[model samples]
Target: MFVLELGLIGLCVALLPLSYVWVKASDDKFRKLVWMTTFLTLDLVMFGGFTRLTDSGLGCPDWPGCYGTASPFVAHAQIAAAHAALPSGPVSMTKAWIEMIHRYFAMAIGVLIVAQTAIAWRARFKRLPLHVSPWWPTALLMLIGVQGAFGAWTVTMKLQPIIVTTHLLLGLALLGTLGWLAARLTPIPVYEPQISRYRFAAAVGLALLIVQIALGGWVSTNYAVLACTDFPTCNGQWIPPMDFAHGFHLWRALGMTADGDVITQDALVAIHWTHRTFAFAVIAYLVALALRLRGYESLRRPANSVLLVLAIQFATGLSNIVLQWPLPIAVAHNGGAAVLLLLVVMLNFRTASSRPGRAAVPTRDAAPA
Candidate 1:
């Protein structure tokens, strides 16, 4: 397994120079291209969420190569057989398509990261720093390798809740990391002196948001979203019966208790209820942070965007439950979370890069060009 993983890394390394050549060969900004790739990666993460939400993780029922082919077009017979055996289960042509699409996007992002790393190294050898840390690319490469392993486990382990939720968190971490790299590549104008003070708060907010997102992922992956199905009250009461022990059981297989018996409604309810309550904490912190960021000129746009995305997330989240997890709204809710993640990432990067205290003080104004 490790050897195959290294072989994939070698492939990524071999593609790095091509990114450099392509960037140098084009009139487009490298940073902008990176950001574009990052955006697509974010979309891929959302689609991955959709895949898991729809129980399509096993749609293809295979590994890196879907059903022993590059796409479902070549594996139609196999998919049909699996689907026919279990009409509402995880195998189907549609599911295979979704799974393959997710892989394609992952490969593209991996290619981009490899390219970025190569360009940085080349630029470094030329006695001009790429102005960005090569370690960022290296870290991305390593993280993706781990993500691939988790992806494999997600299928092999039959979508265990903890593994799936960790996969989701890993995707968010990559999004934020790429967003930070993109921000570093292209400078943002800073206008405030007190921006440094917000850095600590922003850091804390990001941490809290990550935890909340993890809980949400756990709830969704465990099929716990509709456990309660009521607002301001769970099943018509504030404190509904909950077997947190079973619900929080981390090592159990999907739809099964720790003892291997089928899971109960109370367990799902415990999972769903915990996520709902955590939502309150996440929203409150993000809203407060957004309001604080409004005081900074450079951060106002991202702050407003954060607020808007949160509002959309709230609405979509409710719609998912009220509508019994309709596919569209559920997908949108997932996408909204990705957008919020990127927005916060950008804001944090802006705040860090603009810290007057850390930036080199201007000794003299550059002579008029």
Candidate 2:
């Protein structure tokens, strides 16, 4: 019963953007829907980060609903009992609201993706000039379903570090895919033969970014951000003592070793240090890639976006360490990563679509009236 209610809520939330695109777009409604969905997915990713950072992940302690209800309001008595039992623990009215709101937003995004898939198939059946294949949204719909499953697991698994980290990765993956889809729908004029040469480099940069984000997610999920508490060096040592064996153990519960023993400070330090150290390499490679892409006028926008977001990421990341991980800066850091990923995905699409002899083609589908 709660599941159906939740689905209805999601549908209601999704109608706003769907109606906007349907009415105001006037043309290229499909493209507008894709871009709008991409924007909302980015927001969902950042809110997911906030949910994790604020320890609200287990606030509801149930899947797809708060205490098996569609909204947190009805679960107030249960939440109050839990909070009364452990005032500082994971379950609280505020945290429950935060967690449920995040879930609601995610469900809404799921609804939007379904609408996109339906419209794409409709366009295909009518043999419209839809520039991109309908299968793209179909794939996005499938990916979002997997992401929803992981969202449930992140709760059912008790916020296990690996599960939470994987959830973050999958969310970002969905965001990146939507970005790619948006790029495909909106054509850019690219004539540079040299741009295609950077495709491999762009791919490598994106791969490295994914790895770095995974490590960062590991750090966040494990609550290891403040383990080092220093800049340029961890814990005032050029080389800090670390327990990589325990820190990198994938299947263990949160803050515990593989043997079910409580994790040590060294393990936390290990997680934080690895994320910090690898960040330098990721930043350097991406900066160089952005500089290379800047030489081409057609690629300049995304290239500049990369550079700008990279700078914000560096600043926010450093602030996370030196400023003791303020919430705003931390959330901004997470958002910066999402934005950077979007830019890089766009760069990859542009480079791949623009070849030596071919000019970038716009979507062929005429706007449906």
Candidate 3:
């Protein structure tokens, strides 16, 4: 009963965007829908970060529903009981609402993807010469399903560090994929054959970005953001004591070692230090890549976007340490990562799509009749 109600809530939330796209998009509705979905997905990823940071992950202490019910209102008694039992614990009215809102938003995104898949297949059956292939949305649908599974595991597994980190990775993966789909649907204005030369560099930059995001996720999941209270140098020393062995252990409870010992400060420092040091290398490589891409007219916009978001990421990341991990700054830092990933994925798509021998895909100027 609660499952059905939860689905209905998701449907209601999804209808807002679906109706807007249907009514407002005069042409290329499919493309508009995909882009809208991508935009909302980026929002969802950031909100997921908020949910985690607020300690609302276990707000309901269950999967898919709050206290086995649809709305947090229906589960208020249970939530109140838990909060009364432990006022500072993970369960509270506010946290429960936050968690449920996040869930509702995620389900709404899932519904939108389903609509994309359905509309795409319908066009395929009618033999419409759509700019994007139906298989792209189909693949997105599959990826979202895997993402949903990870979401469930993140709750059921008690926010185990690895599972939670993987959940974050999957969310970003979905965001990147949707960005790729949007790029495919909306054709680049100027196709410079030379743009293809940067394809390898863009790919390498994206790969490095993913690794850095994963490291960041590990730090967040383990609550290691403040392990080093200083920037450039950690804890007043350039080389801090760290326990890489316990910090990198994959299959342990949150803040626990494989041997059931409470995790040490050294382990937390290792997680934070590794993420921090590797960030320098990733940033340098990406900034260099963006600078190279900026010389080309066709790649200039996304390259500029990369540079802008990278600056925000750097600023917010520093503030996270210096400001003692304020919630809004932390959330912005996560959002900056998503925006950077989207920009890089767009850069990759532009470079690949402009290759010399490829069949000329429809540009915005040349829509299919």
Candidate 4:
């Protein structure tokens, strides 16, 4: 019964991309489908941030289906009763809706990926105009499936900090994949000579960015945003006391330290301060990489994009501190990080033409399409 309900909801959500594809029938259907899926995935990433920020991660209290049914309306009595008991806990009606909406968006992405996989397989055998290999979409299908599983674990695990943060990371990883694929489909000309050093630089920048993201995720999962309460100095000191042992311990329940004790304020500060201090190194290296690329005219666009998103990320990061983590700014900060990750992914993929070990990168603007 539960599985059937999930399928029903998936079917309902699938109508969106289905209808759009029908209305805009064109030669580039596969590419269009990929791009549409990419666009929706971007929204999903932002909304996922919204869900977490709003504390709606456990709104449904179950996976795939809300309270053993497809919609919150059907579970109104259960949700209301849970709310009446706790009132300000994780089971409110509004939160239920937020969580369920996030699921619907996810289901829609799944359906689109399935369609993409099937179409790519058919096109491969039939020798269609979209003469790309089927394996690409198939790989995306696999990645999205894993992502969905983490989504389920996010609920069943009762929003464990590690699980929730992994879910967030996986979502961003999926966004990067979709963005990279879409960039491949929309090939741009490269008039400037490819530099091996630039590719290496971008790769380093991406690696550092991922590490910073992980640290940031750790801070968010532990609810340490307000731990510092000041800029440049945490707790009004250059470095307040921090219990790194308890803070970096990974396998504890939410709000609990490694030894099953309530996590201390100092531990929270440790988490927050670590992420805060690391931002300097991340920014310095990425900006340097971007500046290096600016010397090449063709790489200037993505290079500038990297710098721009970097500034937005830094501003939002500070706003979260000074502004007390306002919802709009917080969510946008999450989105900005995802965008930065996406930009770096594109930079790495597109610049592969110069990477010594990489296969020949695809480009449609060789002579100009």
What lDDT score goes with residue 207 in model 3?
Answer: 96
Number of backbone collisions per candidate? 0, 1, 0, 0
Kindly list the per-residue Cα lDDT of model 2 for residues 109-131, writing each as its tens digit: 99988877877788789887777
Tens-place lDDT per residue, model 1, 1-369, is 533553464455435544544555443345655677687678888899888877789987767766677668878888898889999888988888888777766776777777666666665566553566567788988998898899888888888888888888888888888887777766556656578678888888788777778778878888888888878788998989998998888888988899999999988988888888888888999999999898788888999999999999999888877888898888888888888888888877776766665442222211111
lDDT of each model, Cα atoms only? 0.77, 0.90, 0.90, 0.84
Off by over 4 Å in 1: 1-28, 360-369
Each candidate structure's TM-score, on Cα atoms with residue i matched to residue i, is 0.89, 0.97, 0.97, 0.93
Report how far off residue 365 is in candidate 4 (Å).
14
On the 0 to 100 scale, the lDDT of residue 334 in model 3 is 94
lDDT of 1 at 71: 65
Worst 10 residues of 3 by lDDT: 360-369
In Å, residue 289's CA in model 2 sits off its true spot by 1.0
State the lDDT of candidate 4 residue by residue for 117-236, as single tens digits.
888777677666553567888998999989999999989988889888888888888888888777767655554446556777788889999999989999988999999999988879
Q: Which digits, one per residue and each the tens of the lDDT, describe model 3 over residues 24-96?
A: 7367777788899999999999999999999999998998999899988999899999999999999999999
What are the candidates' C-alpha RMSDs? Answer: 4.8, 1.3, 1.9, 3.1
Best-to-worst TM-score order:
2, 3, 4, 1
lDDT of 3 at 53: 95
Pull out the clashing pairs in model 1. Answer: none
Worst 10 residues of 2 by lDDT: 358-367
